[model samples]
Target: MGDHQIVENAPTRAWVLHPDIRNFGGSGDERPRDPARALEEAVSLAHALPGLEVVGNEVVRLPKPHPGLLFGTGKIEELKARLEANKIELVLIDGPVSPVQQRNLEKAWGVKLLDRTGLILEIFSDRAATREGVLQVEMAALSYQRTRLVRAWTHLERQRGGLGFVGGPGETQIEADRRAIDEQLVRLRRQLAKVVKTRDLHRKARAKVPYPIVALVGYTNAGKSTLFNRLTGAEVMAKDMLFATLDPTMRRVKLPEGGPEVILSDTVGFISDLPTELVAAFRATLEEVLAANLIVHVRDISHPESEEQAADVRAILASLGVVEDTPQIEVWNKIDLLADPTARLNAAARSDDIVALSAITGQGMDDFLTEVSHRLTGLRTEEDMTLTFAQGKQRAWLHEQGVVESEEQIDEGFALTVKWTETQKRRFAAL
Candidate 1:
C-alpha cells in the first residue's frame, strides 16, 4: 500500500493534504462533511500508520482539482517549497489521485506520493493479525495496485519486498504486471475461500449452541471494544486509536439475573471513505453482523460529527443488505467525555431505542443490559419446515436447538413442526 523509503530508526517525514475542491462531487459521501474535520481524520489516518511522522498538514481549498497535477501552478509551487523546506519524503494526499497526476506531482515536488487508499492498505497490511485478514489485505492491495501500475520502481522494490508492479516502462510491462497481479489475486481467492469455509463451519457450530449472537458495530474509535470488554471481560486491544481492533473477536457472556446467555461479537470498526476494495474484501468477515440476532450500534455521542458518523455507518450497513427488520439498539458511548453529561443524557433518555453510557465507567450499564434482555424476549411462533434427504445438518441443528416439537420421516426427507423466536428464524434462514 505504501512505498516510502525510510532509514532505520528514522520515521518517514510525510505531509498531509486534503484537496477541498469546491465543485467536486463528494465521492461516496452523500452529504457534505466538514472540511476541517475531514482533514483531521486524514491526519489521524496518517498517524495510524506506524512509520510515518506527519510534519505538516493542510486543507487545500480550490475551485476544482487539476487533472494533470491536482493543484494549480501557484499552489504546486507553494506546496513544493514547503515540502523541500521541511525535507518531506512522502506526500500523503487524503483523497483519490489519478496515476498521471501522482507521477506529475511526485516529479514536480521531488517526493514520493501516496493517496488515502494506499495509506489505508499499508495500515491494514501492518495491523492485520488473523490469516484471513492478512490474505484479504494482500488481495485488496494487489487489486488496487493493478490499476496504478505505472510508477517507476526507483526505491519501492527495495522497501516493500519486490512488489515490482508500479512504474513499469511500457504497455508490455504494464500488461505483464497486471497479469501478475491477477495471478496473485487468483491464489489469494482460493486461500480466502478455504478460510471462509472454515469460518462458516465455526458459525454453524455456534448456531447449535444455546445462545443468541449479538454484534457490536460502530465508527472506528467509538468504544465498541471497551463496551465488549465491559460485558465479557475479554482482554481485547482497546485503545484510543482508529482501527485499534481490526479482526473480529467473540466471547460467550452470561447475562446477570438469569437472563439469556449470548455470544458478543466485536467487529472491525466502520469508517467514512473506506476504500471500496476493503469493503468488498472484508465482506466475508462482516457476514457475522448479518447472522447476528441483535446489533448494538455504538456511537461516540460526544463528537461534534456523531450524527454524520452514524449516518455513514448506517449507509454501509444498508449497502451490506442488512434489513430494517433486524433488531437493533443505538448506544451513545463515552458519556464520561461529554460536557455536562446530565443534560445530554437527559435528552438521550427520551428514546427507548437509545442508551447513553460510559463503557469505561460502567455508568448506565444495567439499563443497557436490561434493555438487551427485554429485546431478546421475542414472541415465538410454531411453523412447519421440510428438509431434503441431503440436509442432515439443518435437520440436526433444528432438533439441537430444542425448537422442534414433532418430526416425521418422508420420502423427500423429514417434516417438522417447530416453535422459535424471530432471531432463531433468521438464523435458520441463513443456514
Candidate 2:
C-alpha cells in the first residue's frame, strides 16, 4: 500500500508475466516452478486485487535473466508492443525482480510494475484486519521499499546544498527517505513488540488450561477458514480468494461425545514462493503454529497443483522451525470439487493417516473429529517424579495443569505420578 500501487478512478488494466528461467537456483534439488501453473497462479494473484482487470497473461521463456532488464531487448520490445496494444497500465511479474530490473522494465514497457513480492505485499496490506497484522504488513512493505529507494524514486536522488554555517553538505533525498523508513520501522517494531507481548500473555493464559491447540495450515485458499467454520461454527471470511484470511483466528471447540476440549486455530494459508520480507514480518502471526499440539495440513486435493502446494506448506513449516515430532493429520479437503469423491475417499480411508473430506459438505467430519480426539488423547504420556519441598512451585504447576494424577508423601517431599503432553513436559522442564 505504501508504494506498491496507486488508487485509480477505474479498474486499472494489468498483464501478468512468468519468467521461466532455465536451471534456476542451480542447486542439486532445485528446480523452477512449472511455467504453466506458475503463470496461472500469477493470474489468480492479479485477480485477487480489487479495481484491476488482468487483460492478458503469458509465460515468457528465458534462457537466462538479463542483468539490466529481466527480458532480452528483443523479448522486451515484443512484450512492450503487446502491452501497448492491450492498453495495459500495470505489469505483474510472477517472480522476484531486482530493483534495477524493475525500473528498467517499467520504463521499457511504459507501465507501472509490481513483482511477486510487491504484489503479495499489496494484497496483505489490503487484507490485514488486525492491529498487529496491519503493523506487520506496513513494516514488511517499508523494508521492501527501503531496498528499492534508489531505483523506484528517481526524484529522491536530488542533493540539497548545506549553508556555510551548517554541515558541509546536506544529505541526499534518498538518504533522507531511507532514514525516514528506518525510523518508521523502529516505531512499528516497538508497537508490534507491545502487541506481541499481549498476545503472548493470552497464549500463556490458554496454556494454563489443559487444552491442546490444533492449527489449520496449508496453501492459501485451501478451505482452512471453511473447515474451521464447519468445525467451530465461527464465521471467518471464507472466500475463494487467495489470502482471504491474513490474521490467525482461534476458537475453542468441545468435540462431540464428551471428547477433549481443545482450541482450534485457523492461520494464514501458505503459498508457493512466499515473499522473503513476509516470512519475518508474519512470524508473530504464525507463532501460534509453534505452540500447537497438533497441526492439520489442509490441501485442496482437487487442484492440479495440490502436491506442489503441499510441498510449499511443508517447506514453510520447516523454515518456521515446527518440530518434526508434532502430530499432524493430512486433510485432503475440497473433495466436493472432485469428480469421484467417494473413490478418492475410499483410497484415503485405506490409510490410517489421511482424512479425505469436503469441508463444505461436512462429509467425514465425524471421522476427522474422532481422529483429532484420538491424536490429542494419544499425546499424553505417564511419568513418575519425586519433588523436594523446595520445588513446591513446580509441583503446584503440575497440579494446576491437571497432570499430577497421584501424589504420595515421601522423604524428599512427595512422589507423584503424572500424565502430561510433551509440550507440557517441556514447559515444566523450562520452569
Candidate 3:
C-alpha cells in the first residue's frame, strides 16, 4: 500500500481552514479568498487528509482582534445548525483561538474543538520519528498548551513523581498532567541544546573541507526528500504526509563524471500557513539553511499549487534572513508525472542554473549532476599525466586527495587521469 493510503485509514474527522485576517482591515491587505476562500481551502485540506474521514466542516470567519467568538452571532448560529444537522463530532477553527474561546465554543457545540495551532502540533507530533525531532515537537506542543491551560480540567499544572505530585486537592488529573508536561518541556530544551552544539561542531568540521553545502528546501511534500535521496544515495523517509522529515540529514555525494564530493542537506519542508510555534521551535534546526553554500528550491512540477508553494517557500526563507545573499537554483522535480515533459524541462531550464529531472527514473541525472559538479568546483578542471609505478607515495596521495578518473597499466609505469581543485593541483604540482 502507498504511504498516503496508510494515513487515509486513520480514524479521525479533521476540519481545517486558512483565516484571512486581512478582511478586518488589520493591515489593509486585500485577500481574494476572504471567508469564502477559507471554506474552499478547508475543503481542499480535508480532501487531502488520509484514513480518517471528514464528516463535516465550517470555516469560522473572524474580524480583526476578535474578542470572543471569532464569528458574529448569526454566523455562530449558522455553524451550530450545520453541526447539529450533520452530527459533527469536532469543530476545528483554522486560526489560533484562545483557551477561553476554545472552551466556550466546545461547550456550545457539544463537540471537541481544536484551533489551527493545535492541529498543526498534532501533525508534527505524529510525524516526528527521531528522538531529537520528537523532543522538539513536544517542546513546541507544551509551549502551545501552556496558554490553553486556563481551565481546571486542562490538567495544566500538576507535577508528577512526588508525594503531592498532583495539583491542589480540587484540581483534576489533567491539570497535573499539564504541569508534568511543562516540566518535561524544560528538560527537552536542554537536550536539544546539546544536539545543537554537536551540530555546530559538525558544521565547523564541514567548513574545513570546503565542499559547497547544497540544501534542498521547499514546501512540504514537494519532492525534496526524493531529490535528496536521488542525489546523495540516502534512505531518508520520504512520504506524502506533511512534515514527514523533521531533522536535517547531510550526505557527501559525488557528482557524475567523478567530480569532488559535495555536501547535500535535506531539510524539513515549509507550508503556506505554518504555525508560529513550530517555526520558532524549529529555528535551531533550520540554521543549516543559513550556512548552505547553495540552496535548491525543489518544487513538485505536477502540483496544481506549485507556484503558490514556491512563493510561500521564498517568503519563509526571506523571513528567516537566509535568502538575501545565498545563491539558489530552482529545481522543478517530478516531471515524470507531467505531460509534455520536455516543455516542463524547457521551462525550468530557463534559469541560469536550473535542471529538470526525474529523480525516480534517473532521467536527466547526468545533466543535473554535471551542473552540480560545475557549481561545486567553480568551473575548474584537471590534467592527465603518466607516472612510474615506483612513485607509490605520489600515486596514493593522488588517489586520496584527488578524484582518479581513469587508470591503466603500461610497461613503464601507470597512466593516471584525475580531477582536483586548484589547491589540490598546487599540492600535486610540487610532486
Candidate-wise lDDT, in order: 0.85, 0.87, 0.71
The segments of candidate 1 whose C-alpha lies over 4 angstroms from its true place after superposition are: 1-6, 26-31, 152-168, 379-397, 400-419, 426-431
Q: What is the alpha-carbon lDDT for the whole of candidate 2?
A: 0.87
Worst 10 residues of 2 by lDDT: 156-165
| Global local distance difference test of model 3 | 0.71
> Number of the top candidate by lDDT?
2
**Would you list the rank order by TM-score, best first?**
2, 1, 3
Per-residue lDDT of candidate 3, residues 60-115 (tens digit) = 44455456766556766777887788767666677777887776667676667777
RMSD, every candidate, angstroms: 4.6, 4.5, 8.9
lDDT of 2 by residue, 1-431 (tens): 35455566689999999998998768637766789988988887887888889999999998889988988999999998999999999999999899999888877887889999999999899888889999999999999999998564642322222224243324476689899999999999999999989987787677677788999999988889999999988899888788888888989999998789999999997888787778988886788899899999999999988988999999999999999888899999989899878788888899877999889999889999999999988898889999999999999889777677789998879999998998789989999
> What are the clash counts of all predictions, listed in order?
3, 0, 9
Ranking by lDDT: 2, 1, 3
TM-score of each: 0.87, 0.87, 0.71
- Once superposed on the true structure, which residue ranges of model 2 sit more than 4 Å away at CA? 1-9, 27-29, 155-171, 341-343, 381-386, 396-419, 426-431
